[model samples]
Target: MQRFRLADLAPAPWRNGGGVTREIARGALDGATDWDWRLSVARIAHDGPFSTFSGVDRVATLVDGAVRLESATQTQAWTTPGEAHGFAGETAFTARLDGGGARFFNVMVRRGRLVATVVAHRTSGVLAPAQDVQHGLLVLHGRFAVETPAGTERLEAEDGLLWAGARPALRATLDTPTGCLVEVRLSAPAQTDGAA
Candidate 1:
C-alpha cells in the first residue's frame, strides 16, 4: 500500500488553459505520447470546452460546487457534489458553472488498455480489495482511517491510498459521514511466449 498526500501534489495548468489540474498518478505504454491511464483532480474556474483526448475514456465527479455539461446530442447534464459522469474523451463538450467554480476528480484510461469505476458515499465499512486489479481510495471530505495487514493510516481530505498486485483486506472507518471513494481497475495485458 502507498499513501499520497494531497498537499504534495503540485497543480499545473491545463493544455487548453481552461483550468488547473493536479495529477495523482499516471502510467504509460512504452513512453508513448498517449498514456495508458491517469488520475487527476481539475479545478474549473470558468466556462470552456474540455480538452480532447482522442481515444481515451474519462470519468469525472464533482467534489465541490456544481456544473452543467453540454454536448451536441445531450443538451445539459448537471453534476453536483459526489455525482459522477462518464464519457468518451473525443466527445466535444463545454462546462458551465452553476455559481462560482467547481472541483472535479477525473480518471482517464486509454480506450483498450483499462477500465474503471468510481463511487462516492457517506458511510464507512469494510473496503474489499478488487481481484486481479489495482485499487485506490481518495478522501474527498472529512476524516477517514483505513486498517490493513500492513498497518493503519488516517487520511484527511484529499489524501489517497493506492494498492497494487495482490489486494489486501482492509477496514475503513469514517470520522465524519461525508467523503468520496474512487475505485480503479487495470486490465492485465495478454501473456506471450518469448519470441523474436
Candidate 2:
C-alpha cells in the first residue's frame, strides 16, 4: 500500500504540447520507451488532438471542468465529474472545452498484456480488494480516512492510494457528507514461460 499526493508531483510537458501531464505510477520506470501500464493525470488547457499510442488501451475520467471529445466516428460529452470515457489509444480525437480547461485521470495499458477498468463510487464503508487484481483509489472530492494493515491514512481531493500484489483488507470512512472515489482495477497478466 502506498499513498500519493498530487501536489508533490511535477507536471511534465505532453508530447503534443497542448497541456501537461503528471504521471502517478507506471509498471516500468527504467527509462523505457514502452511500458506495460501507466497511470497519470493530465490538464487540458486548450482544444487539440490527443497523442496517439498505437497499441495501448486508455480510460479517462473527468475530474474538473467540462469537455467534449470528438473522434472520427464518435463524439463524447463529459459534463459530469468522475464519469469515465474509454477509447482506443490509436484513435485520433480532438477536445473542445466547455468552459476553458479540464483535468482528467488516465490509465493506459499495453494491448493484449493487461485490462483495466475505471469507475466512480460514492459510498463510505469497507472496500475489500478483489482477487488477483490491482486496486487504486483516487479521492475526487471531500476527505477520507483509509485504514489498512499497513496503517491509516488521511486522504483529500487528488490524493490516491495504490494496492498491488497481494490484495489486502481496507476500510474507508468518509469524513464529509459526500465524496467521490475513482476506483481503478487492473487485471493481472498471465505468466509466460520461456518455451517454444
Candidate 3:
C-alpha cells in the first residue's frame, strides 16, 4: 500500500484562475496521457467553469466551504458537507463559490473503460475483502485506523492510502463519530486497458 498526504502533493495550478488540483493517484494504460481513472482533491479558489473530459465520468464531493455547481441539466448548492455527486465529464459545468472558497474530492473514470464507486464512512466499520480490485482510502477529516495484513495504519485529516493490483483484506474505523473517511473502489472493463 502507498500512502499519500495532501500537504505533500504538488499543486498544479489551473490554466484559468479557478484554483489548483493536486492529484492523489491515477491509473494509466501505456502512457500518462492514456489514464483511465484519477483521484484528486481540488481547491476552488474562484468561480469558474470546469474542463470537459470527453468520455469521462466524474464524482465530486464537497469537502470544504460552500459552493454551487451548475450544469446544463441541473444546479445544486452545497451549503454544507454533503453527499457525493456524479456527472458526465463532457457536460458543461460551472462552479460559483458561496463564500470565501471551497475544496472538493474528485474521482474520474473513463466511460466504458473502467468502473468506479465512492462511499463515505462516518463511523467505525469493517470493510470486507474484495478480490481483483483497486482501492483508495482517504481520510477527509478526523482520526482513523486502517487495519490490513501489512499492519495497522494511523491516518489524520487529508491522509490517504492508495493501492493497486491485488486487493487487500482490510478494515477501517474512525476514531470518533465526527470523522469522515472516503473509500474508492475501481475495476477495469472486460475489454481491458493493458494494465491497471
Which one is best on lDDT? 2
| Per-residue lDDT of model 3, residues 1-196, tens digit only | 8998999999999888789999998887656578888899999998889767999988888788988889878997766553688888888879889878898898999898777888888888887666545788888888899998989999999999988867767778778669888888887766737786
lDDT of 1 by residue, 1-196 (tens): 7899767999999877788999988877657786788888889889999777898889887778888878888744546566788889988889888888888888888887777777775678876666745667788788888888878888888888877666766788888756665555565555668998
Task: In candidate 1, list every pair of residues with a backbone clash.
Answer: none
lDDT score for residue 144 of model 3 = 93
- List ranges where model 1 is wrong by over 4 Å: 29-33, 75-78, 188-196
lDDT: worst 10-residue window of model 1: 181-190
- Candidate 1 local distance difference test against the native: 0.78
Please give the distance, in angstroms, between residue 97's alpha carbon in candidate 2 and its true position after superposition.
0.6
Greater-TM-score candidate between 1 and 2: 2
Overall local distance difference test of candidate 2:
0.84
Best by TM-score: 3
Ranking by TM-score: 3, 2, 1
lDDT of 3 at 3: 92
Better model by lDDT, 2 or 3? 2
Instruction: Output the lDDT of residue 11, model 2.
Output: 98
TM-score of each: 0.87, 0.89, 0.90
- After superposition on all CA atoms, how large is the RMSD of candidate 2? 3.4
